[model samples]
Target: MRSTVSGYSALSKAHKFSAAGLVTVAGAAALTFALVPQAQAADVQSAGVKTVSLSAQEFGVTQDGELAKAADDAAGQAQVKAKAAVKAEVKAKADAADRERASRSEARKPMKPAAKPAAKPAPAKPAAKAAAAPVKKAYADNLDGWISESLDILRAKGIPASYDGIKRNIMRESTGNPQAINDWDVNAVNGVPSKGLLQIIDPTFKAYHVEGTSWNIYDPVANITASCNYAADKYGSMDNVNSAY
Candidate 1:
């Protein structure tokens, strides 16, 4: 019985060593599985972060392009408006110039005229001349009667009366009519009464006397005698018959 008990004890010791080796192998396999899975997860996370940054850069570039196009459109509209305004101003200036030229042309046109003058005239002329004298009828016929009467009167007065002297006195006194008077006779008021064929005044007859008769201015014979004596004493001759006593 003792031998059997020792042999069973040795078998028990061998079974314990085999169980320790199996446990060490199981622990090593579990550690290896856990470390490998952690490494693979870190690599996947880095790749995701790089992809997000690329998307944000592309969005910024698109927004800048849209703003540039809007600015260019606004500049083009401003240029078109300026060109239209310049054209309108030029057209207005041309119209004003045309109106001024028309006014000047109207102001240039023309007018009319007036009248004339007159003339003058001329002058005038002169006049003419006259004629001579003549004789008488009684002196040609009764000259001898007158001569004889005058000589008788002279002889009575103691004076000489020639035939020529007597004839001249008769012619002067009455043109031989013994009844003559001046056509233009006027009566005397201031000096003396006058009378007869010879128109002898009172003063002249009183101053000279005739022989055998009172002085009578109205008697042709008395007047003739007195005038003959006065003429002989004052003037020497009776030849100028028209102008003598």
Candidate 2:
């Protein structure tokens, strides 16, 4: 009986020691699990922070690209506006030149051609006289007619002259003769004789002949008109002409 009691006591002690060891191991495992979760959370937080930083970098890159694109668009717009302005200026100049050329051409053209008579036998003398009276007379035919025509042109071309003024000069210069010439004057001795109703020298005629009239200095209308131009240049207007000059 003593030997049996001793063996039982030994077995009881061994059981108690084994139970304590199991409790200690369970506590260590629980502590290890909790620490692992905390480490994982820390890793997740670090990764989130890195993701946010990368997102910020991407946003900055996008903003830079947008700014560059906006700058490019602005430059392109400016180029287009500049080109348009240049094109408009060129067109305006071309249009102005065309209008000037047209005006000059109009000035060089004849007013109208003389109409042809009808292809018919001769009519009675009274009827013929009546028909001839109705026919439009040319303004360049006589001195009175030439002066009147020149006054009309001067008004249109912005050249200032008057009927009384032109008539007075014409009567004094050449007695209203379209073919008058100054053969014995100082100008004649100089080989630059003054001719025509206005007594204009060849050099003077070539210099001051009206633009829309005949280029011939002896032409009645051309003579009167050219004289007016010269008179205006020398003395503001033909009305001021009262001397040999």
Candidate 3:
């Protein structure tokens, strides 16, 4: 009886240990199945989120490229505008300079000379009259006139002579004759006859002939004046003569 009891006890303990091990194994299999499905679902969700992040990054890159292109286009348009403005300014200045030069050229043009006026005709003068002849002084054609004319000539020639002395000498020499001749005298014998009113020889008459009188020895006034001039020279004056000098 003691050996059977001991064997029964051993068998009971071995069976209980096998049953517990089997229960532990079944629970581990159920937990492993449930955790495997959850891990698969988490992997699918993570893949979806990674695909969205990649799409967003690609969109951001495309937007940055478009913004850069816009900025470059704006800079190019500004450069073209600046160049056009500069060209317009240069053309305006050139046009203004050309206008100024044309204005100066017009101002410097020469003016035409004025026309001259015509001259007027001169007025007519009255006809001129013939000039009158000069009047001559007259004297009588006689011995008294001859003496008076000789006295006038002597007075003009600054020769000193008196009427009484000249008449006395004339009466003694030729008796107041203009055509008288002393043919029988010593002067006549020598071929130089004493002739005229004062009976003056040819050589003596020419030597003492007064200017503005006739050269003819028979001219009464010429003979008397020449004789008076000669007598005045030799005797200081014809008035001092008292004889046939």
In Å, residue 225's CA in model 3 sits off its true spot by 0.6
Give candidate 3's TM-score: 0.46
For model 3, the stretches where C-alpha displacement exceeds 4 angstroms are: 1-134
Q: Per-residue lDDT for 1-245 in model 3, tens only?
A: 11123223111333334434433543322122211233344453344334434545565677688889999899999999999999999999999999999999999988767777776766777677677775655779987888888998999889999888888889888888899999998999999999998899999999999999999999999999999999999998777887767
Candidate 1 vs candidate 2, lDDT winner: 2
Q: Could you tell me which 10 consecutive residues in candidate 1 have the lowest summed lDDT? A: 1-10
CA RMSD per model (angstroms): 31.9, 34.8, 22.9
Candidate no. 2 TM-score: 0.43
Q: What is the lDDT of candidate 2?
A: 0.74
- Backbone clashes in model 3, listed as residue pairs: none
Q: CA lDDT, every prediction?
A: 0.51, 0.74, 0.77
TM-score of every candidate relative to the true structure? 0.32, 0.43, 0.46
Q: Please provide, for model 1 over 20-126, each residue's C-alpha lDDT reduced to its tens digit, 9 standing for 90 to 100.
A: 33235332222221122333434423432233333334444554676677777777777777887888888888888888888787776443344444444444444
Q: Point out the higher-scoring one by lDDT: 2 or 3.
A: 3
Tell me the spans in candidate 1 whose CA falls farther than 4 Å from its real position: 1-146, 183-199, 237-245
1-245, model 2: which lDDT tens digit per residue? 11123223121333334434433543322122111233344453344345444555565677789999999999999999999999999999999999999999999998887888877987756644444455544664667778888888888788888999898988999898889999999999999999998899999888988788899888888888888888889999999989898
Q: In model 1, how many backbone clashes occur? A: 0
